[model samples]
Target: MVASSTSSRSIAVLNTAPTQPSAVETFIGNLLELVIHSIEGVRGRLVGGSPQR
Candidate 1:
């Protein structure tokens, strides 16, 4: 089966499936990733670079 997931940088396959995500999924995923990364970056900056447990 083909499975797709979104990471902080780009879309990734969960397994060795050759299938790709649709254009809409890709576009929305990119926007979601950007928002996630932005939140993480802002949190890091405010938290003084300390790694969370």
Candidate 2:
């Protein structure tokens, strides 16, 4: 019974460990996208032309 409980707890931990990194990765991805867009907007205004392809 003890072994069974221990294994179950480990399994739960393993399952939850992946979720934190995924959330962090998602947040970083969104932040990078926002930064890229802001940079593009600034570049567009400076060039006074449409954004580059």
Candidate 3:
């Protein structure tokens, strides 16, 4: 995640409230979903204790 980009987006949100916040909120919310999914996937692959596949 790029901190700069996220900060810009947040500033935009604060400057101009979307007509429907739920839509924009969902878009931002998906960022976490993707991160969690990626972490779970990597953890699953690493669970065997050996890095070598």
Instruction: List model 2 lDDT by residue over 1-53, tens digit each.
Output: 46998778757766879667567668889999889988998899898988754
| lDDT string, candidate 3, 5-44, tens digits | 8889877876797665678778769988888877777887
Backbone clash pairs for candidate 1 read none
- Model 1 lDDT, full chain set: 0.64
Residue 42, candidate 2: how far off, in angstroms?
0.2
The local distance difference test score of each candidate is 0.64, 0.80, 0.74
As a TM-score, model 3 comes out at 0.50
- In TM-score terms, candidate 1 sits at 0.52
Q: Give the lDDT of residue 44 in candidate 3.
A: 71
* RMSD over all Cα atoms, model 2: 11.3
Off by over 4 Å in 2: 1-16, 51-53
2 against 3, candidate with superior TM-score = 2
lDDT of residue 39 for candidate 2 = 95
Q: Quote the positional error of residue 6 for candidate 3 in Å.
A: 11
Global CA lDDT of candidate 2, please? 0.80
Query: Could you give the candidate ranking by TM-score, starting with the highest?
Result: 2, 1, 3
TM-score of each: 0.52, 0.59, 0.50
